[model samples]
Target chain A: MDDKDRELLRILEENSRLSVEEIGSMTNLIPAEIEARIHALEESKIIRKYTTVINWEKAGNAEVSAIIELKVSPERDFGYDRIAERLSRFKEVRTLRLITGTYDLQLMVSGKNMQDVSRFVSEHVAPMDRIRETATHIVMKSYKENGNTLFEQQEAERLPYSF
Target chain B: MRNFVSDRAREIPPSGIRKFFDLVMTMDDVISLGVGEPDFRTPWNICESGIYSIEQGVTSYTSNRGLQTLRDALSARLASQYQLKYSPDDEMIITTGVSEALDIAVRAIVNPGDEILIAEPSYVSYAPCVTLAGGTPVPVECTEEDHFRLNPDKLLEKITPKTRALIINFPNNPTGAVMKKEDLEPIADILSDKDLLLISDEVYSELTYESSHTAAATVKDLWERTITLNGFSKAYAMTGWRVGFLCAPKDICDAALKIHQYVMLCAPVMGQVGAVEALRSAEDEKTSMVNEYRLRRNMFVAGLNKIGLTCHVPEGAFYAFPSVRGTGLSDVDFAERLLKEQKVAVVPGSVFGRGGDYHLRCAYAVSRKDLSEALTRMETFISGL
Candidate 1:
């Protein structure tokens, strides 16, 4: 909304776990100001839910993911919006987007295993009324996700002390 | 066997904190607040440009003054930022790093026994570099009372018939002090009366938090006499790439270039390529990194004060020099005891030179988590003391 608000967003986007006092110190704002600003941002839906980026494989809960591209015929009045809304209701769909270049819609979906994801695509996704064709590409690995590197980030190697 | 080392080399004392640094290396789990470099890697685009240059077989020695395009970009940047005009073809030479630039600037200007006035509690290399260039370095103490700025009277006191040059760095390394235009005007006035050169190390110029840095060359009547040295190390976090610029009057630059040509030839071609990209496109990345440093400085300096160590908010540079006198310990003792008891490594301020006693230089270039943890450990250590 403003430069200070943008700066606060950038800082929070980088590390949302920072305490109000810590964020206040960094932004040169008092704790009360930071609290009120954060509240306003949340109420305005500018500040979304704070979430963690977990490496599920490391946590021994590895999940299978796929990117589904949908080619759909527009309904008489509803167009792609009806089908998009229907796709969004699926809990397995982590992200849904209207995409350009050879796809009308893209769905990022994940499930407990490859079979589970395939079953969902075959049984539910392709049989939709307006859904004409479906293509699912199973993701093999995630090197980066949600602006975070999925691998162990390299530490800056430096001497303990230097001039 | 006869001593092989020259008198000049022998006379330059080893860093007093060498043993302390060695001790730091031997310890485990030490959160170091002692480094003088940025923690960020070189921006991705800059690195990609360098790699692309190498991949495309652009690896060859650049002209003795570095690539023309980089020099051109630097010239335009200087002119636009400071209104200082320099010919890229004649008045600029890219060197290995600011370290090399400073070394050549000193060698090119200093004659035997010509005294060079260096502000104390400065970067450790300044005095030694002057001595290695066959110049006697006179220390002009910048005290805490003066906010570690070089007072004009002090500068005047140090100048003499033999005084050949004065070297100044702002957004200074150890003290993190900066000189705004008003603060520098008096020093410029003093220099205007003397037949002295000014070697301005502006490597930390972009790191200023409160105000934009004032280049010494931009000061009144100082341009003709000032040798401005800067590089991509601090601002762009490309220290390992080692690209630096030296800009001055054509005659001074010519002299420095001759030495650079014979000794170093040119900066690495890949680095020069990366530098061109950095100047052309890395503004956004540089700004974000600087903003991160500012945030860390505010938080860490406040944390230091909150923990009862009196620290002046550093207006520039990454270090927070706080007085450890209240804890009844010398800076060296403070550093050593803190390291041994708390696993936190900080540089003792006395190693930086005069007016640094009982002070500890803590670099806030580390992450916020590490800084917070280090502060907690330091609080426990101080309370026990």
Candidate 2:
């Protein structure tokens, strides 16, 4: 992507709700050009999905999240990819990664409650093929997520006017 | 009993921005575009450096000329950026802020009855600073017709036998006019023959969108007489830290230093530590902030034009000087009515000085949401007018 496209991405990443005309003004591009570039980026999957960062707890829909570490045997040619793809299809799996060190795979799993998450881990994740050991760490709190602070943002207490 | 306030202090008018500030304070949800400061906090790394210094008990006063390390970094930066050289030891002194630097620069250079020519529609403090230093501030008008860039002919017209110096700021406050190298060449040529010194306040140098800023001292024959003032306030978002640098020839530097050593002692050590870190590694953070400002300027200025407030595109600095003459109201009336009617705060341009009439100084240093909302309200207000 060009610098202008990158700039447009950065702006959208900060606030996806901005209109095309607003983006055009900010990027110094015409509406048509912005639309064309954004269309191209989306077609290439570079722009990805536009999503909102919501504090579910504030919305009265608190959920439980846990990091599950799995030790697994890599099957011949498929290695870890085959199992990773199978685990990715689960609705409870928010994110999955093939990690290094002691863990062969790490998954961020979320559910309606701690018991629900534990049930998912015990029933579905633990009995997976080629799995050796599974350990789940329940996240007690989230201070930051996806580059956004979960807590209150610092308010700059500036005077109403200054030189 | 004799009057307590001295005549110099008494004669200097209060800041024009102060009245609007008091008005804004009483109002609720006023989307203010009046303040000339960045909305961002100091970058995290820079703040961490200052905090680290304080945690390590480095809270004492730095050297009277500020930390040698900061001066060294500043010296190197000036050399690399503008090809201007100054000895860190004797030719540069850190001050509380550019406000203090400008104060001392005027105090050090002005003798009684000396006239200092200032470009009009400028910062509010320049004239009063000269007046308080017992000098005459002769305003050389820079009109909107010329996009507020200081003209050499107008500058020359204000020069007299009593003239001692010329004070200039660009990208200018209130107007956002920037002087490129070519624009400054003739002014440099004019001063090359005269005995006048140039006090260049380059606080907004890093905020230029169109081209890189050209330091006045870098011009031919101007380095010998130009006193450069800059600070971390605007670019680094460290206004509260109050670290500024003054660079000049040794003689003038020493003169300003003498006043600085007595009145201020030194800039805070913690802030100087942060400034060093800013110069060392905050380039990416600075560039990101400037880019954001450029974006905001484009959007806000275009929005103003679409709303029928005809604003000149500001090449540098965050302010948009939009004419309110189309509404058939004076600048002050326009500003007051806008604040009262629409709850959008902007400074009246006339407060800046001559040639500022019938214009409004709207700073684009706020968030895009607020800027958009303010524009909508302003459009409604204008349509109703």
Candidate 3:
């Protein structure tokens, strides 16, 4: 990314709700310039999504999440890409990655509870036609996610001094 | 009527940095680059620890020297980071902030009628703290030619028989100047021959960019006479925690603790708990935070230079002390005019002391948007002038 593109992404990453004028002011770009740059970023898919990270447990959604390791036998032409694409199409799958080592793919799966996650894994994932083996580890807690903390924000209290 | 205040307190001058802030309060939509505070909140885990402490009934006073556990954490962190060792029990005292630590260190070291040489465009608190401690604050000029780094010869020129202490703040306050170990060796050489004390306020030490920070205490034999003060305020974004610590020789620490015990018993217990968490997990958090500030510094510094205001590449801290001489305005006038015309607020560099007359300090701690906006406004203001 160019310098301006990097700065624009950083600003949007911090607070995507900021107005075009606000972004422009911070980037030293005019409003039109900001609009054009953001438009370009969106078209290029550099900014794939703008979403808020919620403290879901606090939000009353006590969903159980797990990172599932899959040892898959790839189909001929596409290697792991075909299976990876199919797995990503599942609404329960938050993230999927093809890998090296003992595991072929890593999937972030979530459901209402432990039983729900188990059912999804046993019924849907484990019985897949290309399946080899699967190991699931539930995420008991999250310390940090997506550069954000799952806690209520604290009030700022900096001293009003230059030093 | 009773005369309440001490003569020492009365003699200390109020900070000039406040003047613009006062004006800013009366204005609307002013984008301030005035206060040198981080816009980032204290990291989540650190704050969580503080909240956890409160939930666990960890309220009440800690030891006058602060909690043993906290001090031990600090001691270990310092030892691993700087190779400077201190006994947690007797050689360290956790104060309310670097402000309080600096105050008591000055009070503990200075006798009446002594002189404390401070390099200028320094932190605003240094001179006032010296005066309040009944010592003369001698301002030694550090020009832009040296990138605001203290020159040993200029320091030597300011010293006299009564010069008992020298205060150095690296990754400095307004100038954002940092000194390499080699840049400091000659000053240490000059100081080693004297019986003077070195009060190194390294609160911004961790915020340094590119170059590694070398704590003054790590200099040859400088540890014996150096009082190194650091805090969670700048690095861990825990300014509200009011947690800071000083590491000195046992004798000096004991002396400072005497003042700390009477004036301020201990830092807040919850803050200490948070500080422990910071020492434990803040390495990665601070690294990322420093990286963000580095990007902002690059953008802001380049913007100022492009607009005809010459700025030294600030190697550390979050400030850009760009010279406003090209605009044909004094530092105060430039700041004032910028605030009035463009509604952007920055501090006049002279408020920081000598060799800062032609510059203004713009803190890049604001959001990237605000920094960009402030720079644009400043450019317009300067061009019109």
Candidate 4:
């Protein structure tokens, strides 16, 4: 994409709710041009979705999260992709990846509480036929997530002067 | 109340750039290309020094010439970078930014009715500072055809028996015109023959793009007469620290320091501590900033030309002095209407002196996104015009 397109993507990534006119003034494009570009980006799926980053703890939805490393036995000729695809279908899995060193796959799963997460790991994950061993790491507290700090961002006051 | 003001204070007009800035300040969502300072924060190490000084209870005023270590660092930096020598102890006085240095330098040599020649379309403060010092500021016009280089022949014509000094800023503000070593040779040759002193403001010296800057003081015989003023403000993003230094022959420095001693006791201790750190650690940071500025300059200048506004590629500093004459608007009218209509703010060039009539000064020391956006708005605005 061109510089203008890249800039528009960055601005939208920061605040998706900004209006076409606002984006137009910021990017030097007219509102109609901004509208057309945004439309093209959306149609092409370059802009996947407009989503909010909510503070779940502040929203009173405290979740128990854990990263579960699994040793999986891949079927002949299918490799690890077949098992990875199957693991991604579970509602409990927030993210899944095939990792190197000791583990064939890693899954980040979340539930309402510790008991709920443990039950899912034992009943669903441990019983799977291809799953050989599982190691679960429960997250006690999250200081940072998704490139944002859990605490308030510090704003240092700048001293102003004429050069 | 009006009568209580000094005549010099009353006579000097309020800065034209400041007037425009005041208007722009009240308006929201204006993409400004008018700031003269770097957009970056002071480097962390430099800021840490200032913080450390505060924590260590180094809150008292520093020596009138600033910390010896800071002066020593500045001395070594000047020697190493520009090959110019100054004794830190007797030939340099740290002032409250380049503004103060310029002020005190003018006061040091200029007597009442003395003429100080300044190239047109330069920094806003030079003339007012001269005027405030009871000196007449003579405007020596430097045009776009000359790439805004001060013409030696033209400078000769402006010289009079009353002329005490010629003040110049290379990699100049408002215009961003820079002179190479060869380009400065002729000017140096001309000035060497003249009796007038040379006051060179090299604050933007580090922002040079294509080639390294040649300090006016470093030219063959001009060292004794040239008062070179520089600071960490532009180079290290330390504007608010109120730190700058003036280097000259011992006599002039002694005189300037006397004025500095009374007018302002000393530079801030924290700022002095920070300057020592900046001088020690900020070379790489300055180089990286200059590289970023170079990129922005290329993008903005090309963008301006592509959009039909003609801007000569500025070789130094962060400003692009683009001619808006093609659009048939006066610089003031162009700037005002652009701000009012397109939500973009820039300074009119006319305030810089005689040769600045139909141009606008666009500072590129802003974010790449903002520069791009501002250029787009300017294109649209000019097209509408």
> Local distance difference test, per candidate?
0.92, 0.92, 0.88, 0.87
Highest-scoring model, lDDT? 2
**Which residue ranges in model 1 land beyond 4 Å of their true spot?**
A74-79, A153-156
Which segments of candidate 4 are over 4 A away from where they belong? Answer: A1-163, B17-19
Computed on C-alphas against the true complex, the DockQ of each candidate is: 0.80, 0.72, 0.22, 0.09
Comparing only chain B with the true structure, the TM-scores of all models are 0.98, 0.98, 0.98, 0.97
CA shift at B108, candidate 3, in angstroms? 0.9
True contacts kept of 1: 0.86
lDDT by residue for model 4 over B1-385, one digit each (tens)?
A: 4578888898898767666667776787788787788889889899998998899999998889889998998899899989999999999999899889999999999999999999888888999999999999999999999999888888999989898999999998889999777777777787778777989999999999889989888887889888999988999988889898899999999999999999998988888999999888888888878867876787788788888779898999999999988888899999999998998888889988878889988888888789989988988898897
B2-43, model 3: which lDDT tens digit per residue? 899988777878767566777777887888888787889888
- What digit string (tens of lDDT, one per residue) describes model 1 on residues B29-75? 98999888999999999999999989999988989999999999999
What is the CAPRI rating of model 3's predicted complex? Answer: incorrect
Model 2 ranges with Cα > 4 A deviation:
A72-79, A129-132
Model 3, C-alpha of A112: deviation from truth (Å): 19
TM-score for chain A in each prediction: 0.93, 0.95, 0.91, 0.88
What is every candidate's alpha-carbon RMSD to the true fold?
1.8, 1.9, 6.8, 7.4
